[model samples]
Target: MTEPYHIDTSSNWRRQAVEDWLFGLDHLSPGMREKVVTAWVSAWASSSHERLEDMPFSPGENPYRLMDHVNDVTRAGLDLGARAAADWKVEFDPEVLVPILILHDVDKPLIYGREGNAGVHAQLFHELPHGVIGGMLLKELGFAHTIVSTVATHATNAPFHGRNLEAHVLHYADLFAADHAFRQMGKTPLYLRHGR
Candidate 1:
């Protein structure tokens, strides 16, 4: 685990940030906490770019790439989940939700070039079982089994065996963000333009 990626436990900012995030997840069981944090950090460590500007995905004209989309979706998921938790009076740890949000798309980078269209990329990556890979990554990082299972099962749709309320929230949030981004990119009709 340490060989492929190094955990910067020395950085106060990173350490503090992680702690704060974990604190939010205090509602979860100890095992869940370990799994979520491990998965979250593993995804971040792998997807982090050298420059912020290098985050977005551009077909050709743009300088960024699809990895940026992954980051954006993750953030959107966190925001949406927080709002939902507040509105529903559900006592959830933002830490738990946040990590799940972040790691939901851990395999996007690996599938980008291989699939040209967004839908195809998603389908192809879905085939690769990113959730399983993410779970393994979480385990490697010392997360608890519960969290690892949660992260791995986040993207799975219902009736097939993988669906949790928290994970579902994160998944919907990602979809919302991606739809918004598609509209922004002029690939779809903007909500306002639809005359709804």
Candidate 2:
């Protein structure tokens, strides 16, 4: 395990996972980093509890924190996407794809939060999955339209016109990361274990 990040300000403990993940991205511009961090900060602020931002999708299912899962996906997605894209001669841009991977699950906190030992989850993202909510928040936070669309469609099963290729990359990348994270903990993800 890595040592905790040392934030210089008083509001240190809040959203440390998100901050640690964001600070690791040196490829992003200062403005972009700020925007990404701000999106998470806004999510945390919108909630009542402090730990909601770190909550996993389901304690019984997911084996890692939501932020950790997102990080793992992003970390794996970049390399995997690039390699796969290169082999297929597909155009893959990191600037466009990285943000989508990082922010794909930004709404997980809004969806599943452990409110005082109760199964308290948000219904605001009921009809609209976390991808749509996170995409909206990302757009309002000044991300590009393509980025928002990829994030939105990542969780949506149906296909749509004007959808960017990175959307599929992100969608599968998330699946790969989820399965890997679960397997790391000696658990099968979505029952993908061979022979059950």
Candidate 3:
């Protein structure tokens, strides 16, 4: 197990919000759960937004927030995992999938900001695509290789694809959630817009 990344979150509201999303996963070990909390805390602490919900899901004229997007992905990923397991007759590990789904966009807060503001962590936001810095952060924090790879490759334009069942499940779940958000915003879904 990796050493814990401890922080004083007694006053941080985001800590509770992060835990609310992460709690009650039967497959997520305590160690893994702490790592997820650490990731969210570390990212938000270094970010510009005062509230997690204040951060938008993507840049530009989108109304959706990062918190909402994360919730959508997590919920979608779990549902997809259950359905896929039933159909394929193979078990998917929530321990793996949940963390990857939760942390896949952990770097977004650093990369984006409230409208009209520059990226809070430009050092990383300007240097790499969406998932690279996030994956590297997880690695530096000693996340397992599978978890890191799944988070890293969950992006649509990532050069290397994740090679695990959890990664595949996360990819589709992410797309489904994104599509739902886009539809709610009255825009064409990426999958339908590009037909890719």
Candidate 4:
């Protein structure tokens, strides 16, 4: 397998982290392991198309660009989730976690618009929450209820009642990836660098 794409590739630390998680998977039952791997492969393959127009881009931006961003965020979340799950000893079905990580941001393209900035992508669209949309998509694609539920609620930040450890990990991982990408592009928010 090719190295997974990440927004921060300056070092190999993330790769090592994922490897460590893979090693821990050996403790899972064979059936469970197979299910997780299958979900991972299916998610990756379904979302792998490089053309943005093929995705559900909004009005102005190239679909390809949007797809690239989605890919970056999704990969970041998956990597972080794996690392966090391993570190926390969270015993989740990898099948659920892996697909949830991959599909958490699937709503971005559908919400894209020319007017607003990135921060409002979720708010601007007003579709079902991205998490909810993700869950629905996963279900449409034949994923189980557990995977759908996890993906749909990953972003519940209000009461925090809707998230599990894996979902929270995915959310934070996405934030980290987005921050890193923006910084690399010289678009890092002022508050992030200087604590405004």
Which 10-residue window in model 1 sums to the lowest lDDT? Answer: 111-120
The lDDT values for all models are 0.52, 0.65, 0.76, 0.49
Q: What digit string (tens of lDDT, one per residue) describes model 3 on residues 1-196?
A: 1312233345467777677755334458878877788888877777777877677777666777777888788888888889989999989766777888888888887778665632234445666788876887788778889998888877898888988889888898889889887887787898877545
lDDT (10s digit) by residue, model 1, range 1-196: 2233344324334334444543234545666555555443444455433322333343323333454555566666666767877898775565556566655655443333222222223233445565666666666766545556776776534224345566677767666766666666766533344642
Root-mean-square deviation per candidate: 7.1, 7.0, 4.4, 10.8
Per-residue error (Å), model 4, residue 30: 14
User: Higher lDDT: candidate 2 or 3?
Assistant: 3
Please write out the lDDT profile of model 2 over residues 42-120, one tens digit for every residue.
6666654476434665445444666667777787778778787878888776667777777777766666656554335
> Which residues of candidate 1, in runs, are more than 4 Å off?
1-71, 113-127, 156-161, 188-196
Better of 1 and 4 by TM-score: 1
Ranking by TM-score: 3, 2, 1, 4
Off by over 4 Å in 2: 1-17, 59-62, 115-120, 156-163, 181-188, 191-196
For candidate 4, the per-residue lDDT at 71 reads 55
What is candidate 4's CA lDDT for residue 179? 63
How many clashing pairs per prediction, in order? 6, 0, 0, 3
Distance from true position, residue 87, model 1, in Å? Answer: 3.7
lDDT measured at residue 194 in model 4 versus the true structure, 0 to 100: 65
